[model samples]
Target: MRKNERLKGKTVVITGASGGLGEQTAYRCAASGANLVLLSRNVKKLEEMAESIREKYGVSSLALKLDISRHEDIPAVFRAIFEKAGHIDVLVNNAGYGIFAEAKDVTPADVEGMFAVNVVGLIVCTKEVIPSMRKRKSGHIINISSQAGKLATPKSSVYSATKHAVLGYTNSLRMELAGDGVFVTAVNPGPMATNFFDLADPSGNYVKNLGRHILSTEKVAEKVVDAMLTNRREINLPGWMNAGSILYAIFPRLVERLGKKAFFKK
Candidate 1:
C-alpha cells in the first residue's frame, strides 16, 4: 500500500479534540481524506474546528460534546459515530489533564480525577470501540501518553502516575491484540504548549518549570497523523525526547536525579 492508503476513507475518533493536539490532528486527518469524530467537553470549539476541517479539506466531520471521564456516556457517542460513519477505524485517546503537586500535597480527589480522565476514560472508550474493530479485524488505537509516562516526575507525581499507567496499559493491550490485526500504539510526547498545563492545579508550581521545554502542539499533531498513516508501532517526535527515554532506561538513578534537580532547583 502507498503511504496514504492506510488512512484514506478511514474514520477516526478523537477525544479532547476542541483544542491543542486534538484540533490540529483533526485538520491533518481531514487533509489525509479521513472522516473525523471530534469529542471534547467544549462543544463550541469542536463545532468551529469541524467547520474548518469541512471547509478546507471537504471531509465529513462531526462534533460531540463529550466528557471522557463519564463512563456512561461512551456508548451513545460511539453509537452516533457508527450510525454516521459505519465504523471507527482509529481511536485517539488524547484527552488528559495534569496535576502538579507533591505526592502528599495532591488530594485523593486530585488523583482520582486525573485517573478518571486519563486512564479510565481511555479504557472505556477503547472498550466501547473494540467490539466493532474485532468484527472488522482492523483498527488502530493510539494513546497519547507523556514523557512522564516512561519516567517519574517530582511535583507532578499524580499526573506522571496516570501516564505511566497508560503506557503499561497500551503495551499490554498491544500484545493481546497483535494477532487479531488490530494495532495499538502509544505516543509518548514530551512537554507540549497545550492546555494540559493550564488544567494543572491552579495553586501548584508544576507547570512553571515545564513551560520552558514545551513543544508545539501542531508539530506533535503532525507526527500523530503520520504515525497513523504508516501503521507505526510507536513514535516519539523531535528525536531527542526518545533519546532521553533510552538514557532514562539505561540509568534510572541519573534520570531521577536530573528530574529532581530540574523541577526542584536549590
Candidate 2:
C-alpha cells in the first residue's frame, strides 16, 4: 500500500497534540489522510490546531482537553472520543515532560509530577485503547520516549527514569500484542529543538551545550509518522546516539568513563 493511502479514513488519536512533536506528527498524519482526534490540557489550543489541520489537509479532526496524568479523566474523555470517532486505528502517546536536576535536588513533587505525566499517564492512555484495539485485532501505539531512556545521565536522573520506564513498557507491550496484530513502537530521539528545552532546562545550558546536534521536529515527525504507518518496532533517531545505547548496554563502565563529560554536563 502507498504510504499516503495507508491512513486514509483511519482514526488516529494523539495525546499532547497542542505543540512540539505531537503537533508536527498530527500534521503529518493528516497529510497522510488520517482522521485526527487530538487531546491535550489546553482545549482552546487543541481546537485551534484541529481547525488548522482540517483546513490544511482536509481531514476530519476532533480536539479535546485532557490531562492524562489526572487518570480519573481518561475514561470519560476517551468515551467521548469513541462516541464521536467510532473507533481508533492509531494511538500516539506523545504527551510527556521532564525536569532536569540531580537526584537529591529533585523534590518529591517533582519526581511524582514527572512520573505522573511521563509514565502513569502513558500507561493509562494505553490501557484505555487496548480493549478496543484488541477487539479489532489491529491498532498502532507509538510512544515518544527518548535516548535518555536507554542511557541515564547525571542531571536528568528522574527524567531518564521515566523514559526508561516507557521503553520497558513499550517492549513488553509489543511482545504481548504480537499475536493480536496490535503494533507498539517506542521512538527514542536525541534532543530536539522544541519548547521542551524551555521546561527541561530553563538555564539554557543544556541546549547551548548540545549546539548543532539537536534534531529538528520536522525530521523526527516524518520518521515517526512513517513508523506508525509501517508498523515499525522502534525508531531511534541519529543512529550514533542509538549506537551509544548499545555500547552502554555492552560496556557500561567503559562508555560511562569515556562519555561522562558529555552525558553528565552541568
Best by lDDT: 2
* Quality of model 1 by C-alpha lDDT: 0.83
Off by over 4 Å in 2: 1-3
RMSD of candidate 1 to the truth, in angstroms, is 2.7
Q: How many backbone clashes does candidate 1 have?
A: 0
RMSD, each candidate, Å?
Answer: 2.7, 1.6
lDDT of each: 0.83, 0.91
Taking the tens digit of each residue's C-alpha lDDT, what string does model 2 give over 145-192? 999999898889999999999999999999999889899999999999
For model 1, residues 34-141, the per-residue Cα lDDT tens digits are: 999999999998899999889987889899989988889988888888998898999999999987767889898898899999999999999988888888899999
Measured by TM-score, how close is model 1 to the native structure? 0.92
Per-candidate TM vs. native?
Answer: 0.92, 0.97
